[model samples]
Target: MKRTDIRKSVHDFVSLRLDDHQAFADDQSLQALGFDTQDIEDLMFRLEDEFDLTAFTEEEDRLLKEAVTVNDLSRFLQKIARH
Candidate 1:
């Protein structure tokens, strides 16, 4: 999937999950958006189901841990799609 599409998906999911209307900025951290560990886990599972792909391969888990913003998740998804 394209990066832009991945980003839009992430933004939409987060906004819907949080019931927030504000646009997501690339630099906005998930922590700043109020996503706790459980929320992040839920989102990871949700994304995995939606994309029919696992998000927790050892390397991907490390990548996920480093992801702090919507853009980061989008980039991760883009990379995953390649493999």
Candidate 2:
């Protein structure tokens, strides 16, 4: 999928989960919007289902831990979708 599509999907999922309709900035941190670790995990599962992704690799999980912003998750999804 295209990068913009991936980004919009990420934003929609997050907004739905948080019930927040504000526009998200690329550098905006999810934590600032009240995302906890559990929320992140849930989001990951949703993304996997939406993108028809297989199980994540160890390296990819590690990269996920480093992801703090919408842009980061969007990029991560884009990278995995290409694999």
Q: Where in model 1 is the C-alpha error above 4 Å?
A: none
Candidate 2 local Cα displacement, residue 36, angstroms: 0.8
Cα lDDT of model 2 by residue, 1-83, tens digit: 88888888898998887765777788999899888877887788798789998556784577558878888888788878877
Q: What is the model-wide C-alpha lDDT for candidate 2?
A: 0.81
- lDDT tens per residue, model 1, 1-83: 66666777788788887755776687898888888767876776676677776654784667657878767777777767777
How far residue 3's Cα lies from its native spot in candidate 1, in Å, is: 1.7
Best by lDDT: 2
Every candidate's CA RMSD: 1.8, 1.5
Relative to the true structure, candidate 1 has a C-alpha RMSD (angstroms) of 1.8
Number of the top-ranking candidate, with TM-score as the measure: 2
